[model samples]
Target: MPREIQKAYKNQTRSVDGKPGKKYWQNSVDYKINVKVFPETRIVEGSEIVNFINNSPDELSEIVIRLYYDVFKKGNKRDSRVNPKDIGEGVELKTIIVDGVNYDLANSDKIKRYGTNLTIRLREPLKSGQDLKIEFEWQQKVTLTLDRTGAKDDTSFFVGYWYPQVSVYDDIFGWDRLDYTLDTEFYNNLSNFDVNITVPDNFLVWATGTLENGEKVLPNNIYKKFLKAKESKEVIEVVNEKDLEGLKLKHNTWNFTAKEVTDFAFAMSDHYLWHAASVNVAGKDVLINSAFPKGKAEKHKKLTSIQQKVMKHFSEDVPGIPYPYPVFSTFIGLRYSGSGMEFPMMANNGGSGVPVTVHELFHMYFPMYVRINERRFAWMDEGWADFMENLVIHKFFNEDKSNSFYSRFKLVTQGTLGTIGDLPTVTSSQYTGDSYGYQAYSLPSLTYALLYQYLGEEKFFKCFNSYVKRWAKKSPTPYDFFNTFENVSGEDLSFFWEPWYFEMGYPDVGIKSFEEGKLIVEKVGYKPIPISIDVVYKNSKKSYSKIIDLSVWKNDNRTYAIPVPNHDQVESIVLNSDFPDFNETDNFFPPLKDSYEEKGVKSSIVGNYYVEDYNIELSIAKENEALVIYSNSWVWLNTILIPKDSVNFNTSDKTGVLKYLEDVSGRDEIELEYPKYNLKLKGIKK
Candidate 1:
């Protein structure tokens, strides 16, 4: 279905069954940055030297650099709808050196710049299995641009994409030509960094890499607390108000180093709150931390606890893989949009709720560990993160909240499921109009949740863990994700992928008719949906979920019959099963067996009859396997949906004088031998 990534498969760089091909290869680099930030002037000057390694079998004629910060520059193409201000000057190249020779990139006619992408022409071809060192000095006026990498105030800043980063060169798309839009989709190769940051006194630096000279930069009192916090599981205040008030200021350089990371980012603030903690995940001390402004530290008091839980959940639950990074942090500062952005080891977040904390921290396992290009296939990372977000919320917070508006509010109410102007999730993030966030975030998340439900937790976890582990630290196309699930689950999931990703639609399964032990359902929409069956027979009552594969509708067969085995004289067979059905009119068996009272009697179903005079939309809510009908208009029904504690609740007799109870306002009243049209049912709540 994703024909765009087939070239990697054809070239043997990727396999059809979700594994890296025998000829798989990727380019890497080692970058060192020495930068000084003038917070007062809002300017940044940096010198970077990249040791680029071209280990691929082919030769290279040129290189591409990603000047992502240029998205803030005027006249550049941006995915963000916000207006661009020219307060931040575009990157000014001061000097350049290639290997041992100096190249005038500022005046070279061979160097080309277009928007955020720069194409550098090489003097000589860099042959296969060769390494080249490229150095450059540049400066840019720092602007706290919207979305990410912004300054909360003149003296506090979060810096990212400030330096020109080497773009990825892979077997699939040459040079990773995907443009650096405003947000999402950072396709990159694994790179190491050794950064030295120079800042004025009273400034604290938080970076992506591990701090090497913390003992030198931090005050002795705070440095002691920092060391103790990394080894301890409890939250430790590294810098307190006393230290802030008693600081002896001077210029200092903070040195940091990291290996096998995709990129490097750092935040410097003069008056910000810092919280540090640690969690033992996969036998390693992975630091759990958060950084925000003063007086707002209480908003994120439980952030580290949420991080610990998410780290343990994603590592032990579905897709059980170890936490790969040495640190995980949340940095919330002045963000225009109240949102969160995931970075390796750290996240630029806004909300402080535990669910949000879990969502951002779980991203480390996704694009951070399982390095998928978020630009082209945001669903790959966001979908998985959101899916796990609900799962953790279900297991830890409330299971009822997992599939409801209370937990995943953005998911159940929006996206491709039941919204207008929605596009296919497989479409690139740049082209999907209006509903890109919904399609990218929640639709595919629910799709994967449904897939997990269909496969059962065991098979689902096994397949998911295998896929993530296979692609850990590697850039994988979406096809790799599809193929791996099919390979590990031992089922061709093209039925699941095609409709959910390539097609633009939602699930609209309708019950056609029913008789004896067979019920037929019409697939009104292309999505293959799971069906729930609750059968109360004369002999026994059985409640079981049936997962119907998409292959059932592959042949243009719009209908399929599910035979209820050994269940005669059935009482009910509810469809949609309360799983966020957009329309619920045709959701149950015996035609219409739901009872409701919204305002007055808008419609009624006495026994097995549905009235056409005044009708209402009917849906079934299955909580803990008990059926509760939800109605758009007030209505009542008889001979179906009885209370669980009623005298006839377990009865199989069709003709029985059953006493029922109802609540008008507060008091409960009992009625017997009432008209079926005006029947009162128990367990009714408004």
Candidate 2:
């Protein structure tokens, strides 16, 4: 029997913290899982039994065990099956045994129910320093979906969180009672994991850790020998060749092992062709592996070459902390709904271009190696991931930082302008919807880009390394990240985070107008990011630039009309012409005409003129003046009367007055006016 605390003490403790304090119990978990696959049935049976070692000074009461069942199974019909569970074949609860005693599932306290996770109450609370063992058996039928584990193609499978696993109990949030949503990230403790996967005899496996039993597979003798090996042994042999033909299945069982991993997933396919290269990252040997179909093996080779280039580039940028694992595997299968996902030493990539592979692989350094609670603060993971990915792409591809990378940051920042009023990163619920790319991915990336601009490259990287080292394998909130930078750079950054993350506002710097040798700029919008204006103007035959100091206007909209000292020589002006400004449409001076307006003018109006009604009016000025006129109408003899002709004549036909002449000869000025004809004439002497 467990020792019970007095009601008075419990009430007193509850009053102090509003719940059980962190000192109530010590929680530590280690998992060992064995998974076997039947490729024909597309069914996977996973058995994971976790050992929870309690070390709290106080006696434990009820413990909650979470089975990530929602990742695999479908919920009931009453609950709309829109979750990952509803899409994939569901996993049934075969059994849940605790300490050799079977508990009644019907009467168990269901803590909370979402589509992906089910929480159950422990039968009896174990005391401090006590141990409890829980075993679960479930079958998963993998299907393709936007989240969770699923099949990408006939041969390659992308599996993750497909089994019932335990949730985390932390000092802060206790049980981490968050429903599995699209926007929310994941939080878990670092624990030891042992996984065993079985597939068709011919299939090759790529997993999270090192292969512990590579030498155990002898020709045609692995299966019989593997059965005799105990679970405690480090090596196991696998031999099953009934399915594969025309291929040697003699050495089959691929035994692997890893320590201190938060999650585990692997891909197996007979059709997968594999290639690997080893690189030294931070004095550690890291293997880079790629897998693709046989016909696309050459493409996989090219991808591996690019991967090496990216890995080397990241090492130079963010030095120290070498890759922990032996193998970094990238599986290229069919395109999934999700672009890319990062695991500890593995990443799933479905991008067609070179940048996608680099982006996904860089995650191994950011959130994967620097483990953070992704569910609570996705920006911490995704933002850093995107930032590092861009750095790698820019560095390796020799891309122009100001254009390709910074231009994209500007575009995404502009796109997310008005959406800041939607919700906070911690409170807003719309983060998981289709707009996730805009809010979660793009906005955070832009924020980092701005940070890079504010702190410079060296200080920004130093702050990044400090944050990664401090919060690795722990849950870090947005405050923790901000504080890390503040502490390292010795500068307060709350002002930066206020508008960038909390509020959705972006910088809108544009050229309001340029006239009379003055460059007028209008800085609109609220977000406080650095303003860089590139003033391009012509000086004589050459164009010169004067960079205006706009960084002072980060807070308020201030109009600046800077006078160009060389006004007479100025021809054209371009504001932020290099495309560094977030919005470039309003950056250019002498604004380009609208497409519709430009198309409206007649194409044949190059040399044509017309008057509403031709009434004969003539005027003459001094000598040496000449005039020329032409009329398409042949009935009227088109003639021009100049100031030099000193004579004037008028026709008196009344209705047929088609002729008029004026001759001033050498006179200084002469003017002719006809009141009856409703005509007036004026002339200038040259």
Candidate 3:
């Protein structure tokens, strides 16, 4: 552990048993903000008054504030490329006040501006258990390049990170001073918000928090539909195209209030469709809404329905926690074609699809509700979201468990091992660089899934729920998470946690040899993963499979031997595991090979031989002195099958072997030795 974390433990701010220390405390703020949007001018003016409470033991002279929109400022360092059109003077500060004393704008020593962070030298030191009030007035221009927060189109916008707020001061870190580089997400203090947004008449606002005065801003008929949708079991189209054709707003100010949330965002458009529905979660009606461009209403029609299913699945099934927020909304228009971003109670999604929707909404349980530090430990949030997405997809969409994206992620993970892309999870998002996506989304998620399978459903949720319950709405470091799981599971999981979270290595187990009545397996990788083996008998040609639990690696053993019933009769043995193995070619006992025989066939007899009964088509065409046999039914058959005297051919690989026979009476036959699927077809040449 680092010295800062050790100091944190000594100070009793964080405990060893995976719970907040007795003296744990964090600073927070209460914000009252008002903003006005000018769609025609692409400008947003904002003002805020914040009441900051100093809950930490030591806090003094200076306070840091984050200006998130400064990523668009000229000459600012950014991890993501921004459109040149979006570049401009960042957050123009018009006024700054501290505890009713206005600071001079021309004072050089009083304020320091660097990157996205603004340091305000306080006139008087703020001691422990004290509070101060501050005010700020600023304006920023919205950009056409739709990032997490920008204009999605000419009339549609999703606004986030648009406020001037104090940075987080926690026990682990004095003050989170990391710059908003547009690559990493964020870390924020949970606080209360009272926000009022003003837009032109006929423009509708869907935001983070509950709309405190919906009836005041919306038309009477539209407000009625919104109210009915909250209680109705069916989806209600509150703001359809027909409603927008003649829609007129009675008032322009939209009031909203949210408590104990990390951040807030809102989406507004003059011609967007709004669909909403309600679902029972933890005996409470949680409203789910979807907003999309009016032209793409048909594409996003099922968004609200999918959100309803995701909410219920998360609440009642795996992880098994009640929905944390009162409302869930998804805004489905981004500048990119395929992307999504998650906010407190809202999501800005690009494509109207199930996978992205499931992945984004599942984030509520991670960084949103659990309050993990996404800037430092993105894996804690993104990984779980990625892992749960496949589970939800498999459960609700009936996707095959073996064929789900989660199971297939091993392919992607293994390909990156020993390469620059295989960075450890403990590395910060900024330093991970090219490997950021894999480290944050694949490694941790796959490890968590393996741990889940190791500890059955009951024990896994017990530990999972405890972690969420303990850290909900509070920031937690990676150690806090590891300690919590270890404390709950009543076991030291250092062997499992170290290599996966901190070290740079991969998981691989291969068959060493089969001797006497025992088969020897070697641990070829650093990670401790479960083992799966399949054995075939020579006489009966029957196969027997066995799976060893992950606990077998608890002792850090290098090799293990398992007794087989008929070791001498073992014809072939194959080892397969879901864990991301760097090299799977060595898993076979005798080692699998990819060798094909050369069959020179005459290309003069060019004909199409297809099975009319099964609707399987095969076309043989001569191209560049080679015969290309294309089979429309199966992928393996679409290969270059060289012809010899226009008669017969054969090819074999580890996956399957193919054999073809041509008869003179216009009859042709094909045979494939596909495992568990033996296919033989006899067709006539046409």
Candidate 1 runs further than 4 Å off: 1-6, 81-84, 106-108, 249-251, 334-338, 399-415, 418-422, 514-520, 533-574, 580-583, 588-686
Name the runs in model 3 displaced over 4 angstroms: 335-338, 402-406, 515-518, 534-546, 562-572, 594-686
Better of 1 and 2 by lDDT: 1
Q: Which pairs clash in model 3?
A: 600-643, 600-644, 601-643, 601-644, 602-645
Task: Give lDDT for model 3.
Answer: 0.78
Best by lDDT: 3
Whichever of 2 and 3 has more TM-score, that candidate is 3
Structural similarity to truth (TM-score) of each candidate: 0.80, 0.72, 0.85
lDDT of 2 at 660: 25
When 1 and 2 are scored with TM-score, the better candidate is 1
Writing each residue's lDDT as its tens digit, candidate 2 over 586-605 gives 65444422311333422111
Give the top-scoring candidate (TM-score): 3
Residue-wise C-alpha lDDT for candidate 1, range 288-353, written one tens digit per residue: 777877776677677666777777776776457778888877787645324677767878877666
